[model samples]
Target: MKWIRARLADGNDEKGSACAPGAFHALLEDDRVLPVRGDPYNGHERTGEILRLDDVRLDVPVVPPTFYCVGLNYTKHIATEGLKIPDKPDVGYRANNALIAHGEDVIMPADATKVHYEGELVVVIGKRARSLSPDEARGCVLGYTMGNDVSERNWQKSDRTFWRAKNTDTFKPMGPWIDTDVDIENMETVVKVNGRESTRFHTNDMLFGIDTFISTMSRYLTLYPGDILWMGTDGHSPDLADGDVVEVSLTGLGTLRNRFVRER
Candidate 1:
């Protein structure tokens, strides 16, 4: 099942009522979306109202309580950056404010000269867990989604932390929807800039996989429903410019596309 959070596109309560009841939905096989009574973690009771997929606007799949990230997980990406691979799985945090939905514009800061996209697989947690074993970690995940970890290279290098460089508003474009079933081991990631493919890699080609990150983080902190972990991307992105469109596609999962625009 693919879960989505969206609103009717007829301009009624467009900005307001994002979290209103019946906003959560399930994408049906017949190209329709069915509003559900509850979320994916708890259980989704059908609302019996089905609408054409084209009649709705997609929103961020979920408003995550915690945004987690795994850094330097991809070996190829690390090698491309000329950095040493870490021995242990390390988890980082990202701000929720940076998250935007598919079709949104990623606003490039006026001072940012080297903006890049990191296409990644986002793990959506469904069950509360702590001290999980590597094998148990997989059971806690509800599904997977795609995310674009947009970064400003200049600030990323100059600043001690990625506070602004990575957490800037609209920097993270996630969602077409979350796929409850995914073959992670067989997945592949392809990234395109303005209709041209720029980066491609095996999605599971990580130095540290999802199970490691979850188990490592769960040892110290609890993983809760609605929290998300962004598995890092592979390879590098070219310097993005104004009006450039980026599309991130994961096998079986859908594509997440966003345009970069200069901040006015």
Candidate 2:
């Protein structure tokens, strides 16, 4: 099932009846969505009223309780940067404030340069998991979505912790929607800059795949439903500039496109 968070496009009033109070609704054919009523951390439903997708403005599909990311997990990304592969996963956290929905503009910091896009597959957790084995890890996944791990390269190198480099407002563009039935192991990722293909890689090419990362993370802390993990990106990306449009596409998951505009 495909899921989305949307509100009627009449205005910015998010209290519209198209979706539940705080949960994502399942998308249906005929441009409609099944309203989900209940806590998303557990399970939800399509029991409520149906609304047209075109009539509502799609928001970020999910706002994860804990946004985690694994860097340098893709072999090509490491090799391209001439970085040594780590024996263990290099996991990190991303601020929720960085997230933006599809059709949103990524406001590039006026003082920044060397902003790059890292097209990646995002895993959304469905069930609570702790100390799970590789076999059990995959079961915890709720669905998959597309994301751009936008980064300011200069700040990444100079800052002690990746604050401004990775956590700028509107930096992370994830959506279109989430697909619950995607084949995570064999998906293809394609990235476009200004409508031109810039990077392409198979989802399974990561040096450390989902099973490993999920299993590893579970050993440290409990992962609840609605938690999300960004599975990193492959290959290199050209620096983004004002007016540049970036789109990240996963084979089964839809494309997430955002335009970059310099902050005034």
Candidate 3:
């Protein structure tokens, strides 16, 4: 079942709805499309009364209580910048609170010299999990969404710590929608800046896969519904600037697009 969050006409309220990520998906089992008694998540099928998807503004799929992201989980990305490989997962660095939704503009900091886009595969947690085994991590995943880990390269490389580099308001571009039950294997994680392809990465090359990522993080924190774990990106992810159109696409799921503009 595919789930989406859309901003209502009021411009302040959001209504979750049911929709197919692609034309091939079935909405019958989707509680967001059709109602069923005593749904597990209490998700109601509130379709039609709400405006059509093309009409309503899209937002991030989940207002996550936490956003846990990994660094250098993909080998291709490591090789792209001529960086050394680390033995264990790079579990430091995070971006919370300032995550921007899909179709939202990514603000380019006025003082910043350069801001680059890092396209990645992010997991949306549906089940609450704590200290789960690596083998059990995939089950906790609610689904997946496309994200661009927008960063100020000037700020990022300035210091060893990454907090400042990742959190400028509107730096994160989330959505088009969250796709459930996807086979991420061999899927293309592509990034395009201003209609030109910038980076191409495959899910198959993830050095530490989703199962490993979930299991690893669960040992340290509790994974709850609406929690997000962004799997690292692959090879030479590119940069975006003011007036640029950015699109990230993953196979099975559709493409997510956003615009970037300089902050006044």
Q: Taking the tens digit of each residue's C-alpha lDDT, what string does model 1 give over 1-264? A: 888888777655564533353455566555778877777887768777777778778889988899998889988888887888899987898999999999999999899999999999999999999999999999899899999999998898899999999999999999989898999999999999999999999999988889989999999999999999999989999999999999999999878999999999
Q: How well is each residue in 1-264 modelled by candidate 3, as lDDT tens digits?
A: 676664443432434434333121112222333322222243444433433454445567666777878887777677876778879875654666567777778778788777778888888888888998877778887788888888787788886777768877777777766778788886888788888888886765877888887888888888878888778787664455679988888886677887888888
- My TM-score estimates for the predictions, one after another, are 0.94, 0.93, 0.84
lDDT of 3 at 23: 23
Q: Report the C-alpha lDDT of model 2 over 1-264, residue by residue, as the tens digit.
A: 787876566653455454544335566554776766654456666666766776677788888899998888888798887888989886899989999999999999888889999998999999989999999888999888888989998999899998899999998888988788988767899999999999988887888889999999999899988899999889999988899999898887878999999999
Cα lDDT listed for each candidate = 0.89, 0.85, 0.71
Each candidate's number of clashing pairs is: 0, 0, 0
Clashes of 3: 0
Clashing pairs in 3: none
Worst 10 residues of 2 by lDDT: 15-24
Ranked candidates (TM-score, high to low): 1, 2, 3
lDDT for 75 (candidate 2): 80
